[model samples]
Target: MNRLAALLLDRRLVAPDLLATGPIPDLRGPVPASWQGLSRTVSVSEGLIALEADLLELGCALSAPLRRRLAELDAWELTIAGRHIVGAMRSKVGGHVDHVPLFRGFPESVPEDAFDFYVRRVFTVLLQEPEQPCVLCGKVATVHPVSPCAHLVCRACWDGSDFSACPICHRRIDPDDPFLLVSAPDAEDDTARDLVPHPRLRLLSLCEDPWAAAEKCVRELLSGQAALRPEDLESVAAFVDTCAPRSARWLPDVIPSREGKATALAALLARAPETLPDLLDRHVDTATDVLRLLNAAMDGDAGLRRARPIAARCPAGSAGRCWTA
Candidate 1:
């Protein structure tokens, strides 16, 4: 039996009685060459989907667009040998040209919009949820983010002290990088609180070397205390690659001041720096451009140039800039 038929049969969508009906007038479209069963058939200019009763019911979960198309269609027309299906037309023409061809589920090339929509949705959901337990320490925290190296760490595994670098994925994060504290549920304001900059807590100053802090954050991600699913981790790693290069230097040091700042930043990427300094040089320009855009919306004004969210970048050598950097 065809996979679709098997799927339908398993779901109990079609009855055995219908199966023996000898190719009922299922005017779906040109049936697949492989379909075979009782002999009777119909040939419509268009093709139709032939699914078991349960399989048709399962279609309810499909995206709104696909479901709508399926819902508007009429019955599936069986092919003579059962190898093909004839689809019914919403509007029938007098001539044979109205017949539609059956298509393989897989298309040679998908529309750009459709492909992009799928890719974005797939990665977005993957990053948010994984099918398997985290690969790092194996703890099961529901809210884990991936490190640059693609390890899934739990919050408990990363209590913010000691060893840097993800144990499983091996992405490096500085111990001193500022981490955003989750807002307390009772707190009225939802603004994120930085772990650094506590007046009495001198050890956690904003001036703490950012690279070291980022390394620490990466370590926490790999420990599995904040566990992320393996697939989710991979997706986050993928998201990092598509993003443009970001500045690694101290973000607070480079907020843009006036007009023409965006143009200046585009020029800075050409200059190279060694180690952290190089990272910082790249960071300066990226940071300037971002701040200007954000501030642009202060009075309900629209931003002229929107900066892509910084969370898309590799979590290595940079973390102090906040989640949306």
Candidate 2:
């Protein structure tokens, strides 16, 4: 039997109408030529039946009672079978016409909205089935989300890892996709915190070099750390200036001015010795103002003179005189 028919029959949603009393066809034997593409299986004793056919043909074959039963249940999957054609019954009309058709008889050019609608209907019906244990840990599921493979997964199985893709189907979860369920905000926050490299040792192990380690340390500190230690800030500034000199300029904007700004500036100057001269030449006025600030914050001229190499590259004019003076 087709997947949809098997699902409905297993759920006991559409059983054979036994009181009608007629010779039920044997589905296990060879079906007639007229029923070539269709498969129908009926069991009067168990009150179970399975039916599969082309979209249009299935509409023409089901009994009035069975059709009425399916309609009452809002079975969009079966109801939408021949809906693309004109004069289709309103009861059978699918909500959206943009999805690709799942049946073999459907035209290849069917719209994407129609295909998506079909897949969604399948999921809707599948969700109604009794909740199954989580595919991963076999634990009782409190919540269900559609996996990339269209299977329903328990929240416990889903939450055990940091995977954005389905463990079963390996399909990536798109947050905006209608077919998938979005995680709750608190759950997402918990997941984020769990994934973050916490504790200095773990963060350090994840980094390949000193620069990366410093970046991780800074990220951890900025993401709601109660206080910033002076040594940590100084280390980050030095690492950025030494390994990524051009990135030094960004520190003034990202690091709060109240948090040891002078110490950071000093580290930047010490580590970015080579790039400092070119940076000063490019932004002579801004560099001069910053140097003046740094000098004023220093204890003596010896510390200020450390920036002399940068000052020598100033433009040869009034700007140059202003910088040297």
Candidate 3:
């Protein structure tokens, strides 16, 4: 298999579910019929209208003030491909790129105060989920992040297994870790803010490798296809090894934690499409969780076991290992 396919084949297949940043549509309306057109693709929903409508409603619900602001903005210019919302921007002076469509525009030229107005407005609407009960548990959403499945689950109710498939589109979650967690507000003081990556963000990051697999899976999902490769199981094992332990204590209990990783491996072994994205999105309490789990798994292995102690004993040695003071 090629490197991309090889990555998928290496892990135990975990089916991807609704784990995208926002709700993307299916085949959108603006398909580039020939090679000359610029086609926009979003991983969330199938098309722009579907994506926009949802956000519009969400924006309105955020606040009457925000709703008024949205009403004042010029009409949007949109491109649709199949059900996917390919592109969106306001038809105004220096239209801004609508990355998530939570706001009308986010142009660099826009004043920070104006941008902050939009930002705060969106958050107000988002924070009002008590009115919109979760699709899974039917409870007010305290910390629900919508999965690709489009089903919202309360953080308290999410089992991390229900979304074992691309809930909305039915793609397998790649076994590569695509997420991280911060225990509390201060945990992220030293981290970068890449993806709304605040310390309190429910799930912090995604796995780099599986994100590639997700790209491929998106094609397969759109085409109604399935895939299985023996190498994927190995990839799952390797992916597990990537988890490094952190110092925080809440690292392991959030989701399937261990079971989530195991489930991905099992899916690879079974060669079935299970929702792996939801599991990958769990929070970690600390880096120590990753290290401890990895350390225990490496115990019986001759190569790793032999090397760990040597490095542990020589804190300042040539080896890359560092002692924990």
Candidate 4:
């Protein structure tokens, strides 16, 4: 297994040459028979710009939003592959690169956002009566009960015993659950391991403009179908405060969540004091929005949830200059 872990995949597995040439990915190697006359390097030199589109055409197993992020790149270099592509054969030229691990496969039955689906699933399972409503669809139905925990599932929605834990309750079942067997010698008693699947590396590179690179990384976190996680919201606010306090494009045109709006708005206010009136007019939809923004500025979670709101110097007036709160 260690040997396998150390093994690098053939760079040809998803060759840039064949991918850019055709409408589909195929068993054909990099260069086609017709293109045999052209310089191989010249032909593929268009370089992986259509990468995301090609992957989508190939029916890649990645989730929807992830596909866009995985495609974000400025330039491609073979030398830098080792940094982001795990077990990648390093090239002569290199810089900072980071890897995003992709699970081999998981439930793709629904088009829901994966993280949002998991959280809603956990809540849906915990709060409802076992047999009253289907855990996934939330409809009252004739449900089949999984053993021991008796978490009712719509069998149509779930494949039985495919889970390491009760699909509904997220707890251990008896020894006979098809996913595990105490009788097997190699059954290590691991419950949480199910969440951590064997991952494949997706290579990511930064954009040349450092601000654009920072914006893209931060934007990916906010572009998800779900609201920013409480912890993640705090981290984003802190990061933006340090990085892009004044760039309006650093955030989306509309942020739907309350915590996200407040945390971000406050960060801008603290970092760039001139950020107020115009930003508030653009973002604040209601009185409550202003209150949350002010609350974060005035009395926050000790600046953990946002940047410490700062005071801007008052402009000189005919009357006199005085500091405003």
Q: What would the per-residue lDDT of candidate 4 be over residues 1-325, giving only the tens digit for each residue?
A: 1111111122112221212221221211132233233332311112221222122122112222222333332233221221122223222112222211111111111112322223232223323322334545545454544554433456666656456666643456654552321121123522112221112212222222444544654566556668677667766675567664444557777666666777776676666656555667677787777667666655464224456654432222311211132
Evaluated at residue 283, the lDDT of candidate 1 is 38
C-alpha TM-score for every candidate? 0.18, 0.23, 0.22, 0.33
Off by over 4 Å in 3: 1-44, 48-57, 60-132, 146-151, 155-157, 169-171, 174-325
Query: What stretches of model 1 exceed 4 Å from their correct place?
Result: 1-61, 66-225, 243-325
lDDT per model vs. reference: 0.28, 0.33, 0.28, 0.39
lDDT of 4 at 192: 17
Predicted candidate 2 versus true structure: per-residue lDDT over 76-133, tens digit per residue: 2322322211112111334332222223222212222332332343233333433433
Best by TM-score: 4
Best by lDDT: 4
lDDT of 1 by residue, 51-109 (tens): 21111111111212222233333333223212221121111122433232232211221
Alpha-carbon deviation at 313 in model 1, angstroms = 16
Q: Distance (Å) between predicted and true CA of 236, model 4?
A: 2.5
Q: In candidate 4, which residue pairs clash?
A: 79-91
Report how far residue 297 has shifted in candidate 4, in Å.
2.3
Candidate 3's TM-score:
0.22
C-alpha lDDT of residue 136 in model 2? 48
